[model samples]
Target: MAVAVAVAALTLVPLAYVLVSVVAVGPAEAARLLWRPRVGELLRNTVGLTVAGCVASAVIGTGAAWLVERTTLPGRRLWTMLMAAPLAVPAFVNSYGWVSVTSAVEGFAGAVLITTLSYFPLVYLPVAAVLRGMDPAFEDMSRALGNGPWRTFFRVVLPQLRPAVLGGTMLVGLHLLAEFGALQSLRFPTFTTAIYDQFESTFNGPAATMLAGVLVLSCLLLLVAELRFVGRARVARVGAGVARAAVPHPLGSALPVTVLGMAALAVLALGVPLGSLAYWLVVGSSTAFPLGMLAAATATSIGLGAAGAVATCVLAVPVAWLSLRRPGLVSRVLERSTYIAGSLPGVVVALSLVTLSIAYLPTVYQTTALLVAAYAVLFMPRAMVSLRSALAQVPPEFDDTARVLGARPAGVLWRVTLPLVVRGLGAGAALVFLAVVTELTATLLLAPIGTTTLATEFWSNTYGLAYGAAAPYALLMIVISAPAAYLLTRESRRTVPGR
Candidate 1:
């Protein structure tokens, strides 16, 4: 209970600080700011880009997942790897890569393109997992009834895919709402960039807080809508039976077209960014690889990532256990509260913490503790989802058996549950670590003075048009993130029996 309280307090402090500071400005002042033309314009752009990006990602991601998992596409294994690989490229890096290739890629179109490319993998990964696990009986039955392939897919398969598709779409929407790097790079005005500008240029805490308040409100509305759209359906299977494998749909005459389209998307999304990185590395001078800065940034990134991952997993455990095991309104609300914080832009979370620290916790202001708190808030949901899935796999009968054998609840958990879910916990930690390592907006606002992580170092060099200097940091980030990505992929594969 003390551990849970401490975790909640740490998570809530930054949030409370932001809300209290923003509301302190009075309703009238906040209302007046909301009525401004600039605010309206920013709101419009933010909403527009979010909608556009989410729609594009859903279409592309779902299509890719379907093709690779269900269709007779050439190089299915290679395609699956390529589809998920974009996650390794940071949105900012992809933005810069696109802009480097063509001047035209620097506005609304570019914002949508970069964000879609960077985020589609979120949708693809989960949807593909679901497709792999789905019982193909429904589709087979539809086909046996003389329905065409398209009709069978839409009527039989699409309905069952709702949970995975909606889950992926929610992730994409939340990400788009909080997106900063790609939108900023594309010269698009969004609440995140505006809040960031206020902090960087004028150091106006009140203004930034006000913007964050609005962003949070928007996220709340989206969350409610997502819950409704996703429904309360469970995707897990019931009973014991051997589920037959899905028969791959034959491409027939459309094979050439299908292969060509997939190849083009792979080239645009994966090939382009990787090629750009390689190009910069080759053309850039040898001096760009500064051993000292690289070493420092690498050490800082690993330490912060490890700390944040462990902290987030610890914080998430109580909430996940409560929601999954306890199961009630309070637990549900607590679980949802973390998602709200997670969905808000990273800058908002950072700025809120900054304001709170200055006003109330002055000593901890700008400290590594505050920075880690920010990471925990932003990435806790990643830990929760992985942990929840892992916990579900451990049967309640195991605990019952242990209790019958003279073990207490704590002993049962420690002796049995903990060992069973350690891999899941590790998977969750890996996700949080990867997210923290690549995080930019929150780190920019909250990192300790004179402490530069690889993300910050890369952003600093890239913003100054020193691509050469940025290359090494970007490469290091990619290297650090690669192992986590592999772990996630491996765990995902293991989720499918006999994979």
Candidate 2:
């Protein structure tokens, strides 16, 4: 209980910063700053991007999942892996690639496009898993009742997809709300970019914190909508008969068309960025490939990514355990509070840490420990979700039985529960590692003096119009994150007909 309470308190640091900053100036001043025209403009851009990205991601992700999981598309595993490859390419990199090819991608359209490409995987992975695991009995019944393919999909499959889709969309919205590098690179100002701008300016005080507070409110609205929209789903089959794979809908007449569509998606999602990188590597005459610098950056990125993953997962376990094992209002609130960090941009979290560290823990300022703690606080929800899912599958009965058989709590955790959820722990770590390596804004601010990761190097080089020089680091970031992306794919593919 103490541990969980401590974790929640730590996670609320950003919120605390906002609250403290607001109170310092009094409520009327806070209200005036928030009501400014600039604030209104930022809200429009942020909300527009969020809605557009969510819609596009929904369409693309669900369509791709249906094609790979339900249709008779050859190379199902290969297609799934290819579609997920975009997740390895951060949205900022995608913008870099697109802008390098043509200078036209520099506005709202660009932000939506890049974010959808980068985030559709969030929607794809979950919906795919649900579909893969779906007893197919429901779908089969609809088809047997004389409904056509389109009707069956709309009436039967889509309703069942609602909960998973809502959860995935919620995640995508949260990430989009906190996005910085992509929108900043695209020259599209949203609340997140404005928040960063305020912080970077000479008088970054109440205004930046105010923007963060509004962003946090936006996140809370999303959370409430998700709870209401995805309320109380009973997503389990009740039958003695075993579940099996739904018969693949034969793409008899549309085989060539399906292949072409898949090819188009693959080209747009994976090939374009990769081809651009290859161009810079081989053909760009001005490209300055700094081999030694790239290597050092790669090493630093891996170290930080690995450390963040492990640390985030370790911090997340107690939170997940309380939410799952203890299961009460306190645990639930703590879990939700940790999730608030998800809605905060890295800059907000970093600035909050800066304020707290300078005033309190000055000794640890700008240290590796401080940076890692920031990573844990910012990305803990990813680990928490994975761990919670894993824990949910471990029936409480198993723990009870182990305890009754002369085992203590620690022994049961070490012997039974931990072993069962070990894969989940690994998955959680992989998720955080992938996120940390591609992370830009927070890393830029909180990293110790002279510390440079692949992301920072890429951003710096690209920002200076050294696109060719940035190519190597960008490519390497994608390469390093590919294995983690594949792990996520395999994890999502666990739609065993019978769990």
Candidate 3:
């Protein structure tokens, strides 16, 4: 418990840095910067994009999950994988694909389109899993009560899906709030992009810090909203009856339409970016792939990702254990505190670390260790969520069994609980690793001066208007994220929390 609290504090370094920096600037300076017309525009854009993106994602994700899970869409299994598989594609890569094909996706519409396509999987996977495991008894009862499918769905199905819906929506909001790469590429000036622009153009000036403080405030607002919407609702079953399987809804005359819709969505979300990468890979005129530099960047990204994955999983253990084993105010606070830093853009986290390190730990500034720490902090929630799911699956009987066999608590954890949750640990670690590898803002700001990563290299090449040169790195990122995303989909089917 103490360990979890300490880790939570460590994860909050970004928030602490922002608070201290903003306070040091004095209210007059903050008002001068954040109270301006430009600040208001940024806020409007940020809030608008977040709300619109979440709505679109909720609709698309929930719709896709329902179709795949409830309807007799042919090859629903394959379609299910296709729908969720977009998780592997980074939003920036999706933007690069669309822009490479056509420049029409600019400003608000483009930002929402690309983000919804990229992040809807955040909603889809969980909802689909819940739909898969959902008990049919309730729906049957609704039918017996003479409620039509539509009415039953709206009143019964949707209400029961609240936990998954709200959880997924919260993820969408957070991703949109923290999103940098996609928004930047799409030319939407959210708080995150503005903060990055300020830091890049001004080099850690007070203006950048002030902008970041506002972004942090935005993140805090998001956390508060999530807490209210996703309160501690009980979703567990009270009885021991085996759950009946859901009856698949027949498509009938809608079969061709269902197939077309599913095909179009899959092609748009998964096919376009992959097709774009392949096109740039083989046919571009400026195709001067830097094999050696690509290799070096890949090596750096993998090293940092692997290290960050381990560190994040280690930090998540106590928090997840306490949340599951000793559920209470402290555990929930420790668990929830990790979400704030994660929702701020990587630039905010990176700049916060940059300020903290330069002010008090200059020697560690720009070090690989510092970069990994930032990754762990930013993605700790991913690890903790997966860890808690894994922990929940490890029944108490195993612990009791081991203890009765004269095993110590530590022995029970290692010998029994660990074995049961090894898959979940892998799931959590893989998620953190993939997130770290694709991570841009923190790595860009906190990495060692000479270090280059796939994300950074891709950004550099693209920044220089060399799309062909950046293709390999983008392709490599998708390749790495593919299995991790698949692992996550598999893990989502486990003994997840209620609904």
Which candidate ranks first by TM-score, i.e. highest? 2
lDDT of each: 0.78, 0.84, 0.80
Worst 10 residues of 2 by lDDT: 231-240
Which regions of candidate 1 deviate over 4 angstroms? Answer: 1-9, 142-148, 285-287, 355-363, 388-427, 496-499
TM-score of 2: 0.93
Error of 3 at 112 (Å): 0.1
lDDT of 1 at 15: 63
lDDT of 3 at 307: 96
Cα shift from native, residue 228, model 3 (Å): 1.6
Q: When superposed on Cα atoms, how far off is each prediction in RMSD?
A: 3.0, 2.4, 2.8
Better by lDDT, candidate 3 or 1: 3
- Candidate 3 per-residue lDDT, tens place, 1-499, comes to 6888899998899888888878898999878877889888988998999999999999999998899888888786587678867877888889999989888998999999899999898778767766775777889999999999999999888876776777678778878888998888888898888878877786756787787777777777876776677655444444555466788998899989978988999999989899998999898776776779878988888888899999999888777777766778788788888878887778778877877889889988878888888998898867765665457534565577788999997787678777777776887798788789889878877888789899988888887768888888998888877887877767555543322
- lDDT per residue for candidate 1 within 1-499, as digits (tens), equals 3455456666665567668877789889878767789988988888898888888998899999899888899887787777877777788888878876786988788888888999888777766766776788877889899999899888978876775666567767777777877778788888888988887899887877787777778777876776678655444454467567788888899999999999898888878777877888889663277799899999999999999999899888877766666667766667666766776778777866777778788999989999999999888767866666566545566667899999986788779777777777887898788889889988987888899999999888888888777888888888888788776665544443211
What global local distance difference test value does model 2 have? 0.84
Residue 74 in model 3: lDDT: 76
Please identify which of the two predictions, 1 or 2, would achieve the higher TM-score against the true structure: 2
Q: Measured by C-alpha RMSD in angstroms, how accurate is candidate 1? A: 3.0
